[model samples]
Target: MARVKRNPMRGGNKFKLGVFGANADGCLSITRHPDRWMADWDDVLAAAQMSDRAGLDFFLPLARWKGFGGETNARHISYETFTFAAALSGLTEQIALFATVHTLIVPPVYAAKALVTLDHASHGRAGLNMVCGWNQPEFDMFGLTKPDQVYDQGREWFEILRRTLAGDAAFDFKGEFFDLKGVEGAPGPVQQPHPVTLSAAFSPPGRDFAAGSCDCIFTTFTTYDDAKVTIADFQSRVDKAGRQAGIFAPVHVVCRPTEQEARDYYQDYAVTRTDDAAVDQHMAMKKNMSGSHDPAAYDLYRKRFAGGAGSYPLIGTPEQIAEEMIGLNNLGFGGLAMSFVNPKYELPWFLDRLLPLLEKAGLRI
Candidate 1:
């Protein structure tokens, strides 16, 4: 067993920060701009190394099986997440490496074994972001149907993975979605019990799954006041289950030296050069298949969808962005997962400008 490093996700930073979706072209932005992220291997590796050195907490990759049909055909190419994490494990230290997995597609036993391998490879800096399968087109690519009882299947899938990762004696398990006998794996994860598990949940069943099974839950919000209500509700569920959890939000940021520059850039990429067809396909599918956002967001936030996959917007100067973050922290959000137009080129600037304000505001040390 390798020496286990302290998990940065659970570190003392009052508001944890991470880079999201660098594995996919254009990331969360549905843009056709020439400067859009190409997501080549070299650039991806550079982004991860940059984030690790910048003291960002984690690097979360997207799991996309196919691209949304459009001019750019966003996310058509992506690295398999488990392998991606394993590859990065040896190259970086400090930052957590998270692999996004769809429960229905990847068997629990295989996922468990692979995660332990990642844990060993990373010497304990591995995390899992469990996503109940969404995107019917992606499922169609596998010739599989998205089940109505998806969360139920996810529950059983997690249970099997959990037990297998425990490295206990072999056990038999049967559930509505899966049936397995003599399931067990070797070399448990470096993080005691298991590595940190997260779920991006928005619907009631999804939220319940996160409350019951995850170390943290990711959700989208329209407004702070609305988010407060949702957070309270989710936290209450966690409390009732006699578990502790953190609530996180995802954001797309465009920070600049001046507010005008930030807004201008956001307008340029998200609206002016936005991939209209891509946005249409992405939003229509999301609205129909996933409950990842507020209902109103579908109509009101097309620009936001192009900006960062319908994540909360953080477009402003460092001070303004920091103020919004501080407000989020005050509103009980544990942290944020952020996306940029091109993390390899933009992340350094974001950190150089934002980290000091966050530290000064006591959000980070």
Candidate 2:
């Protein structure tokens, strides 16, 4: 095996890390397999508190108008992301909160207002994860035809967000998908023109948008080499656009204790292959959606599971995971968006066993 090289810039500082809690139970659904697991607002609050105590830097909860993976009935439907962030802001101090917002489903003006509110509520510790809608079924439910021009839609949405959050009192936006006439956004974000804006785009246009506008890009690549190439590609786009390179953060499925223990946990949650119907539904949805079967995307997802790419890098002792994270820091990743097989159980392990190792590695939290 090739030895992983740690980044010199990191010195003793570990990169930032976060978690995903889109599912009610905070578990990644595998097609048809339905597990009666749902996380309540209390769970989210507790998790945030735990992460803060553990010295993690951020906590992100993705937004979905409808569930994509199997386990169809949307769970934890009451707490909208903005509202939840507001509540969490009062509950914890320090950990940054990133709420996902879908551009296709929300107007930019309204989205900006909500995010700005969060910035105030959280004392300027708010961020956004921008997503262009990919679910056709949800569009139909919203009484709209599926948008054929996704790139245009994304660009319009981002432009509006950027402008509105810039504290413009009377900005005009005229685009193919959206038209605004002298719109003003009040209570601009606390973070200067705006709070942190993040995105997870893999296509050429998506990459261009991130390079141009996003402060951070969420990626999902399986291997260090692949991640390096992708980062370099994104940096090139940013350079061409005359913008500084943004932070790169990737989501990982992590299990701990040891590599063998991590593998066992993955098998327990991800490899059982139950719920064929749910799996079929998810696959069908992917098959019908834009960029669903893109060869490169599929290859990355497969590598994540096959251990060539997707295997969790932070799955051993805290020291081990910290070392792996340090390696990624060397590769220029500013942070990680991580998910565990069972957060209720594993999160405690992370705080108790792993966090100190990160501190020892030089990360302040």
Per-residue lDDT of candidate 2, residues 152-224 (tens digit): 7887898888788887478777889987988778777777767777786666777787888877666655567
- Candidate 1 wrong stretches, greater than 4 Å: 1-4
lDDT of 1 at 145: 92
Supply candidate 2's per-residue lDDT for 344: 56
Q: What is the C-alpha lDDT profile of model 1 across 1-365, one tens digit per residue?
A: 33435889878898999999988988889898787998898899999999998888999998898887788898797889999999988888789999999997899999999999998889889999998958887888788898997899999999999999897799999889888999879988889899988998898899899999999998899888889999999998899889999998899999888999999999999999998998999999898999998899989989999999999999998889999999999999989999999998788888998999899889999
Candidate 2 Cα lDDT to native: 0.64
TM-score of 1: 0.98
Q: TM-score of each candidate?
A: 0.98, 0.84
lDDT of each: 0.90, 0.64
